[model samples]
Target: MMVAASEILKPTGQKPAALTIDGLSLEFPTYAGAIKALDDVTIEIGASEIVGLVGESGCGKSVTTMAATRLLPEGRYRVTAGSIRLFGRDPFAMDETELQDVRGKLVSTIFQEPMSALNPTIRIGRQLVGVIQRHEAVSEAEAERTARGILKDMLIAEPERIMRAYPFELSGGMRQRVLIAMAFSCNPGLIIADEPTTALDVTVQAVILRLILDRAKRTGTSVVFISHNIAVVSQLCDRLYVMYAGRIVESGPTRAVLEAPQHPYTQALLRCLPERVEPKAELEAIPGTVPNLLDPPPGCFYRPRCPEANDQCFAKPPSMAPAPDHIVACWRRETIQPSIKASEATQ
Candidate 1:
């Protein structure tokens, strides 16, 4: 029986999403107890779309993406429920050999801290060329040529010099750009940028973001950009998901979420932004600390920190779409819906 690759990839008879994480719940087991890292996290990204995962530290943004890619250490964690799909294929079902073929070829990740990602001993050019050759069956000359072209696209000066230099020789910005170039080098369908610009200066961060956006647009690649800075994501992402503790409290188009966030946690996060406060006024901070994952609080994870929480918030809220394409999980959706409508009317 002969079967085309397209048919095998699209068994459902529809164009598959770039990435899908459906009702995923995960935990890390320790000697004392298991840590609930992600709970019912669901997200779907289409081809060429840029999605942002934003939250405070320890909010499971990194864990969710790492789980989707199966980069987490085996046996150290468990998926209690749910499924992950990359281009309609289950990552957890694949063996190491299959994962190796899928990782760089189908999906790639641009991690934080470029210095840690790159090898200190190898010249930048050779490293880039090696990655290009790994997933692609190209000659050394061709790989080197592609590496140089991608470096040029990153707007690096003296591509030849950069290729010859070691990882330690490049500045922080240059090193991050090299990493971005490497991520796009394989031309994967999906790219997970896990806070790629968090280490750079503000100026360099803007440049790095612009380069990523432009490259992804040109290549038609879907991007999952993880960050703690809501403002940064607002500038780069088409859609936004706001995570609190281990659950997504709000998710919608970037403009809609920014204009009228429905969840109390989301509203508090936006209020804490410095730009939203008057000059010299103290910036508002979300009260209360993130609950310990080992034995998380009952019901809504954000209830403790949410000032507007009522008795009803003691129970977990189901995810609801108050407006088309905008989903939020919060107990106060009924009351908040009117405010969202009012904001829309005013616009």
Candidate 2:
């Protein structure tokens, strides 16, 4: 049986959330007019909590986090609206110098591909040491010791040998572990893991997930895990936000959302899970493709593909909370309250 995240995650006190993105709307400017990449996106991650951002490709999951970290290229995109507070400081107003300090010291990112994230020319030791030394004031020898310690903590045997090897020398899984070590080397307040295990096999993927949860829980670090895999998110995240066509269609505690999904898009995605199907039966797939953002239709972007969409869906529905802490943007939300309550009662 899968352990619930509520059982393992630390309790967040009255302190402000580690990260907050409110009413975020951004567009990428190109020769073919602006493409609205994010639409009124909002998310909050509490201290020491693990939140999952799940969606199909082109749903703006990566863009939302990238914009929060100010990693998107300069002058190429426009934030039409929204504010981001990282540990109570506004990242949008920060300068490059301040951002440099914030990126590694306060917030670190574990990219999807380890090879692309790690430098091929640099040895793993030098790269790890560089991150530690850059973020905190320490001697070269001291940084090296810290790097080695972290590598050992990651369960990378023969730390000395591994550190001396360049990025190209290690396997994908090993390189990813190195990246995870580097992300945790400085003990950042939050870690954004953007599909860090996509390239690995199932066994390696499970190990990577366990390592991330273990380390984050131990260090009191908050994490925003971004992925298209709802099954992985269900197993690991305390809270989940489901996105469709740049807008958050559903969000709540993981168990709550998974047990009684309110949005049609979410239900469709869940149906696509292989575990839900009979053995040897054909897998289900969401019928329509994600909408084009450049010339998106008015009101709900998902209405075009939603099976349950009605006349009310033509005009975007306001967020509704049929259950406490469970929010969905669907005109039919009120009518589903009875089913949600019955499910809860049974649980």
lDDT per residue (tens digit) for residues 155-250 in model 2: 898999999999999999999999999999999999999999989999999999999999999998999999998879988999998998888888
Candidate 2, residue 170: the lDDT equals 95
lDDT of 1 by residue, 105-147 (tens): 8888999999999999999999999899999999999999999
Question: Which pairs clash in model 2?
Answer: none
lDDT of each: 0.85, 0.85
Per-candidate TM-score against the hidden true structure? 0.92, 0.92
Could you tell me the C-alpha RMSD of candidate 2 in Å?
4.9
